[model samples]
Target: MTEQTNRPVPNPCVGVCALDENDLCIACQRSGIEIAEWGVYSDEEKREVWRKIHLREQGVLKE
Candidate 1:
């Protein structure tokens, strides 16, 4: 199998059982929509999520 070029989506679960008012993860900060559609998302779509989480990890984003 060929390797993927883009960064992979992160498993950003923090084990917290709460979804904020906007439905974004309290820990990972991904939107509820993002979470719900994750399974069906293409690898390209997952790359977007990876970008978001990466920014959050770098302290460049909150949600």
Candidate 2:
């Protein structure tokens, strides 16, 4: 039996799936490329992306 030490992070996708003029997703606030590459990103990378998303949501940043 294998022990799982890693838990997958919850996806930020909200089914909006639309990109703005800057190529950033209007709903999830992820860049189109980031959304495309999300499946392959490591947990640390994902966390970084999440941090950016949260910042955007909080109006602390923008793409």
Candidate 3:
């Protein structure tokens, strides 16, 4: 069996897979570039992305 390393942050993709007018994913609130680069980012980087997402959700940041 192939071994799997635990992901520090679970992927935010909810399979909505659509970008809104501002180019942020309607579901996960991540930009297309962020989604594309997610797999290559380190855990720390992923955490940072998550931070931004949470901020957006809370209206502390914009898309």
Q: What's the lDDT for all of these models? A: 0.73, 0.85, 0.86
**Clash pairs of candidate 1?**
none
For TM-score, candidate 2 versus 3, the one ahead is 3
Q: Write the per-residue lDDT of candidate 3 for residues 1-63, one digit (tens) a residue.
A: 223336467899998999999888989999889999999998778888899999988989886
> What does the lDDT read for residue 13 in candidate 3?
95
Residue runs of model 2 more than 4 Å from their true location after superposition? 1-6
* Per-residue C-alpha lDDT of model 1 across residues 1-63, encoded as one tens digit per residue: 346655565555677747788677778677788777888888778778878877866879764
Instruction: Point out the higher-scoring one by lDDT: 2 or 3.
Output: 3
lDDT of 1: 0.73
Can you list the residue pairs that collide in candidate 2? none
- Give me the candidate number with maximum TM-score: 3
Q: Write the per-residue lDDT of candidate 2 for residues 1-63, one digit (tens) a residue.
A: 223227676679999999989888999999998899999998778878899899988988866
Candidate 2, residue 60: how far the Cα is off, in Å: 1.6
Ranking by TM-score: 3, 2, 1
Judged by lDDT, which candidate is best? 3
Candidate 2's error at 35, in angstroms?
A: 0.3
Question: Residue 39 of model 3: what lDDT?
Answer: 98
Backbone collisions counted per model: 0, 0, 0
